[model samples]
Target: MTFDHYGIGHGFDRPGFGEAYFQAQGISAIHVMGRGDDWYQYADMDAAMATVRAATEGAVRVVTYGSSMGGYGALRFADAAGATDALALSPQYSLDPKVAAHERRWSQDFRRIRWRPDSNGPISCSARAVVVYDPIGPDRWHGERIAQDIACHLIRLPYTAHPVTTYLSDAGLLGPLIAGLLDGDFDPQAFRREARRNRSANGIYLGELAASQPRRRVATALSLARRALDVSPGNWHAQVSLARLLSQEGRHDEALSILAVLVQQSDRSLTYVVDLGNAFLHAGLTTEARAIADEVLSRAGDVAHLHAWAAHICWLNGDVADARRLIRRAVTLDAGNRVYLRAIIDYHFGAPYIAGVRGVRVTSWLRLARWMMKAPLRPEPAEAVRRPFPFRRRQDDSASDSAG
Candidate 1:
C-alpha cells in the first residue's frame, strides 16, 4: 500500500505518487489519499485499516509505504493494520501537541488539527520499520525520536534536507530502494552508491550547498553554483542562484545573462518557475516576471508555494493590493504553511520574513543551541535553499531568498 505526503497545498499537476511508481515496477499498489485536515483530523484511520484488510483479503503479505506526513501515516497504519513491514521516508515521530511542542516548523497546523491520541505511544507495531532521512535536516528530530523506541533500521543521508525523497528521486534511488526493501534485499551500501553516483549533477543539492557558505565566501558560493550548472546546465534554480550572486557582486550584466537563459528554458519544475520569476524581477525584467506570476495565479492549481511565489511577484511589481489578495489566498489555501504565514508576518511586522535581516550569520554554536532548543535545523544551505539574496538592499519592505 502507498500514501502521499503533505505539501502545503496540492500540486494539481501531480496525477499519481507512490502507487504510480510501484505500478511501473509491476507491483500492485493500494493508495491512501490525505486531504483537507491531512488524516490527523479528518481521516477515520481505523475504518480505513478495516477497508484495506477487506480489500486485500487473504493476501499472502503486505507492507506499508509513505514519505513525510504520509510516512507518519504509514507507520501508524502499519501498527493498526498489522502490516508486516513499513518503509517510511522522513517520517515524523508524532503530531500530538505535548510530544511535539518543541517542533517549530508546523506548530500552527498541529494546534488546529483534531489530534486524536493525547499520548504518543511507542512504535509497538509488529512490523520492522525502515526509515530514510537526513540527520541534519528538518526530519532529524522525529526520525531520531522514532529510532529510539522502535524495531527499526535507520538510513541517514544528509545530502537532502527534510523530504529526502526529493533528493533521492533526483538520484534515481527511490524506486530501487523501495523495491529492494519490499524484496527483503535492501543493501545500504548499494543505496549509498546510488545516492553518490550523481551527486555532482544534483543541482538542488549543489544550489543548497553553495547557499550555506559563509557570507565572506561569496566567491566560493558563486563557484559552487557554477559547479552546479556545469553538471546540470538546465537547473533553473541553480541558474537563479548564480544570477543572484553575480548581481550581489555588482555584475548586473552577467547576472541578467544567467537569468535570461533560464527564463527562456522549458523546465517545468515549480521552484524553477518561481525562481525564474525571481530572477526576472531581479534583472529588472518586470513585465516578464509579472507575466509568469499572473499565469501561475491564473492556473487552477492551489499549491501554496506557487501562490506564495505569485504573491511575491505581485509585491515586486508594486501591486500591493494584488499582493495582499494573493497572499491572503495563499493563507486561505494552507494556513498551516509557514511560508504563507511568514509572508503575513513580514507584511504585518515590517521584517524581512523571506530574506531575513542583513548578514545574520548563524554561527555553529547557534545551530547547536537551536538543536538543544528544539529540532536541529539543516542550517547551512537551507536558508539559501529558497532565499537567494545575501547582498540585497532592504528596499521598501522586501527581501529575497537565496538559500533556505
Candidate 2:
C-alpha cells in the first residue's frame, strides 16, 4: 500500500496514491483517500478504518508505504491496520501544534482543519517501522521524536531536504531500495555507495545543495544550480535557485527573466509569483512590485506564508498599514512561528530594520526575548536507529495496510 503527500491528492473521487502502480505489479492494495488537507483526520475515520480492516483482513505480509504526510499516516494507522512493515519517507511525528510546536512549515494546512485531540501524535504500533529522512532538514525533529519512543530504522540522507523518495527515485535507487526492505535483504552500505555516486546528476539534490550554501560560495552555488537546470530544465527549485543567485550577483534582469518564466510555468503558483514580485522590487521596479502585491493580496486566501510575502512587499512599498494588517493575519494563522511574530512586532510598531538591526522598542525586545527563551532547541544531525521490539502474533494472524 502507498500513501500521499499533502496537496498531491487526486481527490476522493479518484483512486488513491500508488493504486495504479500496485495494480500493475499485480499486488492487492487498499488506498486511503484523504478528502482535504486534514492530515487523515476524517470525520468518518471509524468508517474508513472499518473498510480498510475488511479489505486487508486476510493479507499475509502487509507493508504500509508513503512519503511526508502519507508517511505520517502509514505509521499512525499501522497497528490498527495490522501492518507488518511501515515504510515512511520524511514523516512527521505529529502535525498537532501542541505536540510538534517546532514545526511551522505546514501551518497553512494545519489552520485549514480543526485538529482533534490525539489524532496526530507519535507512532504507537507493534509493526517494524522504517523511516527515511534528511537528518539535517526540518524532518530531523520528527525523526528524533519518533525514535525517542518507538523502535525504527532511520535512513538518513543528509542535506537531501524533505522529499527523500524523489531524491532516491531520481537516482534509480527507490525501486531497489524498497524491494530490498520488503524482502528483508537491504544492504545499507551498498545502497549508500550508489546514492553518492548518482547524486551528482540528481537535479533536486543539486538545487537544494546550492540553496543550502552560504553567500560566500555564490560561484559554486551558481555552478551547481546551472548544472541542476542543465540536467532537469523544468525543475522549479533549480530555476528558483539560479534566479536567486543571479539576483544576489546584481544580475536582476537575468533573475527576473527566470522568475517570469517560472511564474507562467507554475500557473501563478503564489510562491513563484511572490518570487517574481521580490525580483521586481529588487530591480527598482516598484510599480510592478506593488501591482503584483495587490493581485496576490486579492487572491491569497488563508496561506500564512503568502500573506507574509505580501506583507514584506507592502512594507517595502511604504504601505505600513497594509504591511501591519497582512503580517498580523500571518501571525494569527501561525502563532507559533517566531519569525512571523517578530514581523508582526516590526510592522505594528514602525520599527523596520535598518542595516540589519531593528529599531525595536525596549519593551518589545524584552517580549521577543521571552518568546525566544521558551523556543525548543533543534537537535543536531546524527545516525540513529532503534532495535525493533518483539511483536507477538497468533499463528493465523494476517497483515494489512492503510495507505493514504
Candidate 3:
C-alpha cells in the first residue's frame, strides 16, 4: 500500500509508485491520497492510520512503501498503525533548519516542525523494515540516520541520483525488493555468495597493517578476511580473497569449492561465469570448463568479448569453423578493440604485426586476454580488504610485539 501527498498538488494524480509495483507483482494495492493544505500537518496522521487499519484489517500481511515526503508520512503511519513491514525511499526526517527558518521568515503561520519519534509514540510493529536511500543526499541521509537509530535495515545505494523508486523503473530492482518482503526469505547463503563474487573481482583489503605487508602478513590477512566473511557471509570480496589466497597456497580444490557456490548463485554475472570457468580450467576439469564457457557465451551472446572467449574455447576443442565464426562476430561488434582486431588478424589471416607471433599461439593468447578484460570489476570486495584480518587476536600480539 502507499500514500501520496506530493503527487496530489502537482496534478500527478495517479496510483502511487508502490501501488503500481504491487499491481505488477500481482498483488492488490490501496493508494490513499492526501487532502487539505500542507499535508505535513500531524493532524492528518490519525486519519491516515485509520484508513490503513481499515484497509488491511484481515490481511495476512501489510507492507507500507513510500518515497520523498510521502516516505516521512509512511514511516509515521507505519509506527502508529502497526504495519507488517515498511519500505521508505529517500525519506526526510525533517526539513533542513535553514529551510525551515526561511519558511518561518516568509510566513507567519510557518512554525518550525521536526520529526519527533517520541511524540509519535512507541512503535509496536516487528515488521522487517527497509529504508533505501542515497547517502550523498543530505535530505535523504537525515531519514537514513533515523532509520539507523531505530535499527531499521538500511540499503544504501551509492552514486544513485535520487530515490530508488525513481531510479529503478526498469523492473530489475523489484526482484530484490520482492525477495526482501517474503517471510523467512532472507538468504544468508545468497549474501555470502555475492560477497565472495565481489571479492574475487575487486581485491579486498584487510587494514592498513595487513595491507602494508600483504605477503609477509598472510596469517593476519587471512584472519581478517575470515572475520569479514563471518560478519556478512555474502560479502563477495571476502569470499573471493579467501578463495584466491587458498588458490595461491595450492589449495585449488578448496578455492574451486568456494567459487562453485558463487557460480551457481550468480548465473547471470558474466564475470562470475568467466572466473568459474577459469577456475575449472586451472583444476584440469575440461568438461566443467567447457560447459561453463558455453553457458556464459549463450547468456552473453551480444557481449563481443564474451563471444571471443567462447571462440577460444572452441578453438581449444579443435572446432575451427565455430571458433572462426565467433571471432568474426566479435570483431564486427567491437571494431575499435585492438584485442579483438589483433585476434582476427592473427587467427583468421595468419598476419602478426609483432615479432615471433605465430598465428596459432597469438590467437589463443589474445582470446584468453580478451576474456580476462571482459570480466566486470567488483568493488564491494574491496571493503573486505580494509579489515586485513578475520580472526581473534592472539595474546602475544597485544602484549609483546607490534609486528606480525
Q: What is the C-alpha lDDT of each candidate?
A: 0.68, 0.76, 0.56
Query: What TM-score goes with each of the models?
Result: 0.70, 0.78, 0.39
Per-residue lDDT of model 1, residues 117-212, tens digit only: 622567666787788888865678898888787877788876565688777776678878877877878887777767766777787678777877
lDDT of 2 by residue, 1-404 (tens): 67667777446777777787677867677787687667888767667767776787887677888889999888888877778888888998887877887677777676456776656655686888888888877899889888886898777887677768877776688878777767777776787778777777778789889888888898898999999999888778778878988887889999999999999999999778888888888888877898898788787656678788877777788888877777767766665556776666655555643334544545556655665576446643534522121122335544311000
- Candidate 1, which segments miss by more than 4 Å at Cα? 7-16, 36-40, 57-61, 95-98, 102-112, 118-122, 193-202, 234-269, 284-291, 300-317, 323-404
TM-score, cand. 1: 0.70
TM-score of 2: 0.78
What are the clashing pairs of model 2? none
Tell me the deviation in Å of residue 262 in model 3.
Answer: 40
Q: After TM-score superposition, what is the CA distance of residue 5 in candidate 2 from its true location, in Å? A: 1.8
Q: What's the residue-level lDDT of 353 in candidate 1?
A: 39
* Clashes (candidate 2): 0
Best by lDDT: 2
